[model samples]
Target: MSQKSFHVAVVGATGAVGQQMLNTLSEKNFPIGKLSLLASKRSAGQVITFNGESHTIQEATPEAFEGVDLALFSAGGSVSKQLAHEAVKRGAIVVDNTSAFRMDPNVPLVVPEVNEQDLLKHNGIIANPNCSTIQMVVALQPLHEKYSLKKVIVSTYQAVSGAGAKAVEELKEQSKAVLNDEPFEASIMPCASDKKHYQIAFNAVPQIDKFEENGYTFEELKMMNETKKIMHLQNLEIAATCVRLPVETGHSESLYAEFENGNPSVHEIREVLKSAPGVTLQDQPEEQIYPMPALAAGLPDVFVGRIRKDLDRDNAYHMWVVSDNLLKGAAYNSVQIAESLIKLNLL
Candidate 1:
């Protein structure tokens, strides 16, 4: 007897993360009998290759999802909001890689390493956490399990790639212009929808998404809220300050956390992280070694290091976490969810 294969669809097939998703699926050798590449009407005619086979990009409509057993969506929040249910209605289980259904009470926000069981409860759609949030939780979940996480204070140094492919190109163009002292346009950094744009070539923008009424940018709130939801810690005291850095890929975070358990030694924390699933511990300060975004790019596992105890708070500790925002942050996580679905026999 042969194993069953799925008819999988990749929504947003033309974008950066979308491209990575296709690459990852090929790299992982997922059991796919048929692959459908979907994008906006404007991107419909583009051709993409998967597993040495050519796949045509099609305009994503509710009708396009007809026999799709799984749909991986990364187009954008609006597209997900508009078409996610349509996919679900057509018998496709959706693993959404956007903010669209993340906070929905009925949807499961999943990080397989942290909450793989949540997938079983998903009501047709499963929301992938924010790129920054995904990596942070991967590194923190093991420690949280051992120590019972009480609070988290994170400051993110995100990359331009998190914005989109155009932002990465803008950073390149702006850097060249800056070096030659030529004039350049500032149009994409901070947030494309914001009133004013800032250069991201050699500067940091202290914002990721639109600001909510409470003053936290949507990105920050995603990290804060998504962590709580994924961990099932509704009262987890978490605060986030997300900043866009000039780096082209990977995201880094400076995290300070307090645990309910009494103070644990740095060695103990390192021991916990050493065996933590989906985490790579790279903390060797004597060798001046630690996780850096430049080194973390292109990797699927979350790299964590710089473990130290806070001087004032006995139960508090700080660490640094990094990962490829395009991989584990979005594409890899979405695919992992689909793999989990099959493993759990939910597909």
Candidate 2:
């Protein structure tokens, strides 16, 4: 830890990802001169314990960022859109965890392992890539660099926690009801603001966010777009189908990728991932070992396994990727960006 500390503020302090940010900051021993917890007026004045000390949650207003050095935002997109610029105006570098400013030309969409240098281009606000995008890029970065990726097709099995706390509770309640053969009405599963919600306990919901005009769900589009931005592959062919599963924490994805020049052997791919930053290689078919959501929960590293060559295409490969959605996918990545800024002297 550095001896010089800075004042830090966390927006949406009561939410799942916000709380994880506080925990990550404490666990990583990030130097903190002062900490501010900001949330909506409804959650104001709440007490939260961090590093065995009590701090009161305050309302997230333009004035709340006064004297703050870094502001990590995980609130809804609307709150981020409203307050992020205000924080920047107050001289705070913001690592926003929502999609509000992701596609902005001036904002750097960052995944520290893949694009930490992108932080150097940040005007003030840095956009954290989508949770699913984060883990995929972390795994794909090494491969992309070595093999030169030509195309990517991903199918994600996302956890309920990505939908927020209410969705997690809904899964638990629905699971209990279903086991007891009781009737359960779902009010928030695939999308709360959408027309209908589906059961997420024993079933998988194909939709992650509202559908766009192109028939892709917003979540799927986010993965596709964010991948190109983070990897600096504007012309890369990418497609995603994001589905919500009964799992509570980790997010899993099955990826099919094609390289440009030559096909890399499974051992070569394993070697690339073994040395990749923020990635753990767990491929062992004989032992029946591979990355799984249950094993990846609570970890910061993206787990990659199930490496295999495509049967028909010599330039194609397949793999499985998993990560704790609330950690590496959100909180830990934001904190890592803050660390990257410090390392690169961008802060």
Candidate 3:
């Protein structure tokens, strides 16, 4: 960390992930000379406090990037696509949290624990992977380095927070409606822009983004494809199933993995994870200790637990992973990328 500070801008200042960006900036004590919060017209003029100082939210425009050394964007794909280049043109490096730019060949999608080296390769805009993907890669990267991972099959129990602030409110209202035996309305889960919405109050939704032609939701495909991209492992095999749960925060994942030429015992895995950066090991089965989303809310670190061997395969293992979705998975990851850029001397 440097004594001198940098000017920073946050796009989508009123959103779920946008709020996380502010929390992360303060919690990390990021040497911020100035912080500018940008949102749509609807959220403009709202006030958010940072470092005990009041900062009024401003409307997002191309001009927001002037004098900003870095920009953390979480508004949406369309917003990022429109303004990211403009920010870069103003000499501000962009850490974008939208699906719009993740797969771009010109952009680098990064998680610091997973591929900090990729920061050195950015051309101005850096992409942040999906929240579920971010936590999984943070846990898997160390193990992959030790054992040379061959495959990954993961299922995620994501929270309503990943959907947005509105979705969280919808879940709460619908739950109360159901409990009172009122006609519960369904208009938020599954997909908001779709023809219909499903109830997420007491139900689980198997979809995160809309389905693609291959039958995998766009969110699931992001994990599978983005994993290989970030790891730079063209031959790696990955599969994902993403589901939205009623929880307000935290995302938990069950991962099954196989390693090539890996014969390490469970203890060895624990030792490796304990030494990995931004990761914590909580694998005590007999004591009933494990990672759970309910316990991971509002935390920055990735939590790992339930480490064990799969009975069906000798080189296979199973694990549970947890983290705050909006934090680590989105806003925090974007901030970490900016931090890495500073450390790597790229900015």
Q: State the lDDT of candidate 1 residue by residue for 199-272, as single tens digits.
A: 88889889899999999999999999999999999999999999999999999999999999979999999999
Candidate 2 on 208-296: residue-level lDDT in tens? 98999999999999999999999999999999999999999999999999999778789989998999999999999999999999999
Candidate 2 has its poorest 10 consecutive residues by lDDT at 1-10
lDDT of 2 at 41: 98
The 0-to-1 C-alpha lDDT of every candidate, in the order given, reads: 0.94, 0.95, 0.90
lDDT of candidate 2? 0.95
Model 1: residues with Cα > 4 Å off, grouped in runs: none
Better candidate number, 2 or 3, judged by lDDT:
2
Q: For residue 267, what is the lDDT in candidate 1?
A: 95
RMSD of each: 0.8, 0.9, 1.3
Q: How many residue pairs collide in each prediction?
A: 0, 0, 0
lDDT of 3: 0.90
lDDT-based ranking: 2, 1, 3
